[model samples]
Target: MGAVMGTALGAVRVVGGRLGLPVDDLAVLKDGSNLLVHLRPAAVVARVGAVTASVRGDVFGHFARADELSRFLAGRGVPVVAPVAAPVREGGWVVALAEHVPHQAERTLDSTTFAALLRELHQELAHFTGDLPARGPLDDIDAVLALLSRPADLVAERDAVAAGWPELPVQALHGDAHPHNVLFTAGGPVWNDFEDAWRGPVGWDVACAADSRLLDRAAVQRAYPAELLDHWIGVRRLLVRCWVAATDRYRAAPPSPSPSP
Candidate 1:
């Protein structure tokens, strides 16, 4: 197993012990930068990751934030995956738990349904009235630049493009508003994964859904400012490029050595 997956399993083992659940019964569901595992004989799901930006680095802030947001949304009757147990943070790893929703991953979602859910989400988020990180895609430009081994010309070009965007009305938005982030269930669409949640232009979310090409762009334009939409579209393209580059670097990195017995 890779280091991350091993760490995830170890964290799950710790959490499972505390909950009196069998670690052997746990099954891996999804594995990536984050690990999703199903806690069998229980309705909870464990999301293991090192997403925190903290002093001790014992907690994953993004996952922590998601748990908080889930509770907030659930209180207001917004459909979302619910958290069942307190998160476990130990040994420089975090195992956050949440209630799992049964659903199928549809190849495509109805444009009208998707837009309606987004509108509902926007409405609820507007009243969140809580502190959150401001969403500016370029806010991570410095990190992206470093990750891609910054070229002077590319840095200048990216900065220039970023400078041209005019600020628009800002509110708490689902930072990564792509279709995959949304879960369609028998009840309705449940918005999960609030790790990227931030205060940003509403247009950013609209632009994101549109970029997926699964929504009616014309309908989105009618609901949001065209200028903001265009600006975010440009920003999304840059974000995707940086993501691709970073993933390539990560995949090319040397694997950790196994411990000697």
Candidate 2:
């Protein structure tokens, strides 16, 4: 394992052990903004290092708060992946244990199902009365753009969005609801990753789904004006690109400081 993964895994093991959850068979499911690991012999999957102190401001509450959103949605009959246990935050790293959902990682979501799911998600999100950090993509653009070697072009695009923000309608959103964020499980389609849950132009979420090319653009436009959808599409596309670029750069940089004792 590389330095960052090695440190993150070690922290997860320590945190899981303390929480009395299984950690012996920890296997990485993914490593990006956070390290997702499956603890064998236990139905729990742990998410570690997904939230940092600096980024926590941009996040809803903290890592554990995801359960709040999950329960809120699940209680309302939204098919979000369930959280199996409360989160553990220690040593500057937060780990959330949740159900280890089985899914076809290679499956392609049908256009009709994708549309229905998004519509349902937005409807449910509108009713969430719980507390979450009020945020929008514009809130983190500077941090993301800083990671790029040549950010002039992206900077120009960002400024334009800022100038036009006054006229757009705002609502609760699945901040990063790209196609890959939806998992097709035996239980049916379930939305994963609520770290980006925020209040913003609902069009931002629709644009992200559209960019995934899994949903029909015309169908998406039905929920948003064609011009507005097109505008947010460009905004979402650049945001995603910058996010990927930031992740790649962070992973390639020198190892981060070890977790505090």
Candidate 3:
């Protein structure tokens, strides 16, 4: 839970037990259902990071992939810790109960910090491989454009990017790199939520994710070099503006009159 919905310790214990949480010592985070149980006996907390039955859910196959990636990172001695085990949920949904890190890498990130994490996540994305669900930019671009009330140039830009994107160096990207998905801990920035990860160019995450935030594009441009940052900023604005217009279309569209039978 959080400041919004304060959680109860007793309620936590019950959920913990249901998930075979240790009946002994650790403290529950109360928030981040990802770490659902605290193993008092072992001084560890188990994060309910994945649900097998969540095929149509947010973190469906993510449980398995999260574990694999976590392990992969740890083996490389990257600042992240591998949650205890990346096991599949026992029944129905493939729920995963992984180790909960004492602290995440980053939170409430400024431009510098967020950018650094973006670079780190990009590195992790480069290492990922194996059979995983996929979603293409063509589909995403079309869906986003169809719902928007923007100029056709917006859709045309997306189309152009899609066609030319294949020529770029593709890596596994953290499909959605918005603020909430990144965690701040003592280490640095721990990226989470692999639900939308896909083999794509850094621009998919870099150009796309950066623009989604309310960061000042001009300031970012000033901070980074001229040429490199300029291209990214342009792409970022295009992506974020289109998304904004898309979300706005339905909200701003006029309501239709009721049919008179």
The C-alpha local distance difference test score for the whole of candidate 2 amounts to 0.71
User: Taking the tens digit of each residue's C-alpha lDDT, what string does model 2 give over 182-257?
Assistant: 8888877888877667776777777777777667777655644433777788777767766776666665673464
lDDT of each: 0.70, 0.71, 0.51
**Candidate 2 regions with alpha-carbon error over 4 angstroms:** 50-65, 146-150, 222-227, 254-261
Give lDDT for model 3: 0.51
The pairs that clash in candidate 2 are: none
lDDT of 1 at 150: 95
Worst 10 residues of 1 by lDDT: 50-59
Task: List where candidate 1 sits over 4 angstroms from the true fold.
Answer: 50-59, 152-154, 223-227, 254-261
Cα error, residue 104 of model 2, in Å, equals: 1.3
Compute the lDDT of residue 132 as modeled in candidate 3: 49
Better candidate number, 1 or 2, judged by TM-score: 2
TM-score of 3: 0.54
Which consecutive 10 residues in model 2 have the weakest lDDT in total? 51-60
Better structure of 2 and 3 per TM-score = 2
